[model samples]
Target: MHEWALAEGVIKTIKEYSKDKKIEKVVVKIGELQQIDIDIFKFALDELKKENSMNKLSIILEIEPAVLKCRVCGKTWSFSENLKELDDFIAESIHFVPEVFHAFIKCPNCGSPDIDILKGRGVWIEKIKFKGE
Candidate 1:
């Protein structure tokens, strides 16, 4: 729910920029670490653009992993790699309904939980393709 509130503002900005030009699609570069629910963001966009069909640009997410960098060894790793157990556990708990993997960052190289975040930290509008000219 809190994520939704933050996303509403993003949607507003996206739409405002596309006010003059008819948008073809909206491309969002979301860092894997942001942990945003894509479903919620899409739903919000769909609802908001229901009125203006041309303004209704489809949501395209460029999902990058929220990665951590090892300060000691200078290695980079993704949090997704560490979620195998959690993913399996969720599926088993849900009776094999097919679930997605979710994991936390804990550096394997140095075994340090204090690794620096290298990428995938925030949500950004990378580019917006529009039907102009």
Candidate 2:
């Protein structure tokens, strides 16, 4: 749902910013933390572009992984679990505010819960090709 919002926002932003410009290509950078559906987004992008006079538009998706650092040991690594495993962990932790499960979490290395999210949290419209009449 959040991914859909971001995707929709991207298209809206593109439309508003480009005005009369027609889009030919769209490149999106999705971070691992965002948990976005690339295929669904591709479908949404196609649907969005079809609503306009842009005729045919193509979209490309790029992936970026999130990195977490242990505040105690200074150990940093990419988030290694798939969505299902992450979901299970989240569900078992709090089940209410599962998002906060990462807060003040101790490092598995040094038993320090001071973990910092280092990367991969947002979506970016990396590049776009516009055909202007």
Residue-level lDDT of model 1, residues 1-133, one tens digit each, is 4445556666787768977767777778877655567787667666656644535467787887767677877888776675454454553432222112222345677776557767776677888787763
- The Cα error of candidate 2 at residue 36, in Å, is 1.6
Q: List the residue pairs that clash in candidate 1.
A: 31-120
lDDT per residue for candidate 2 within 49-85, as digits (tens), equals 6775444666678887867788778988666542345
In lDDT terms, how accurate is model 1? 0.62
The candidate 1 region of ten consecutive residues with least summed lDDT is 94-103
Off by over 4 Å in 1: 51-55, 84-106
**lDDT: worst 10-residue window of model 2:** 90-99
Q: Rate the local accuracy (lDDT) of all candidates.
A: 0.62, 0.66
TM-score of each: 0.66, 0.70
**TM-score top scorer:** 2
